[model samples]
Target: MNSAVFYSSKTDMWATPQDFFDALDAEFHFTLDACAVKENAKCEAYYTPEQDGLDQPWTGRVWCNPPYGRNVGQWVKKAHDTASGGGFVVMLLPARTDTRWFHDYIYGKTEVRFIKGRLKFGSCQNAAPFPSMVVIFGGEHKNE
Candidate 1:
């Protein structure tokens, strides 16, 4: 892994591992990727950076591996809002439980699966610096 690429502020994109995505796809049958570039998009219907997924109306089962940055809170918020409106969204996010977004939007509102270990995102040979979690929203009613 290139240290520069790992540390760069502009490089927030982390492609989801195919096998992991496949397993989720088998269960969720995701119909859209809420955030993706052309090369890494898991579904035919996807929102690119230029499209600003946050502004789009999410429908059906959605896969969201949003940019991991200061703005990640916004993505989490969007997911929660979409789910509240009857959309299903599965998010891949860093397990930062201390964050306000985690408490505000996720705590009692969704089903969370904490990954046991760091993920080796994209083609990187090394695991991510932080642990990851799969947060599922809108499959069933939960106290907000």
Candidate 2:
């Protein structure tokens, strides 16, 4: 079976590559992972699904790679609100610029970095079908 089919049948949770996380960590010094399971957490402090990351206090520099399913809007909204409250949040999101959440929360409020190519998430040998982006909120406005 192909990687895409394998992944699709198995899980929607795409673990972020450690090297990618390390590169971002060098700059952001992320203190909390707003969304993560124990096995995939990039930070010492993290919120698992059961913890409902959206309801948690997002203090300091937070790294969020929310689930790519239907509820992504909530996560994006939470990130925006947290940033407005003075916390910094960095998010890894699918580059779906056409989505409502993108226009509503990310367009004017954050600095966006569109990744050059699809990423090989986790241990998958094939690259992600969709492109990805990194968005920063509540930091010094580099895009503005």
lDDT of 1 by residue, 119-138 (tens): 88877778888899999988
Q: Candidate 1 — which residues are off by over 4 angstroms?
A: 1-10, 141-144
- Which lDDT tens digits does candidate 2 get at residues 39-138? 7889999999899999889987899998888898899999999988887899999999999999999998789999998888877888998899999988
Q: Residue 67 deviation, candidate 1, in Å?
A: 0.3
* Stretches of model 2 off by over 4 angstroms after superposition: 1-9, 141-144
Q: Indicate the residue-level lDDT of 18 in model 1.
A: 86
Candidate lDDT values, in order: 0.88, 0.86
My TM-score estimates for the predictions, one after another, are: 0.90, 0.90
Look at candidate 1 and give me any clashing residue pairs.
Answer: none
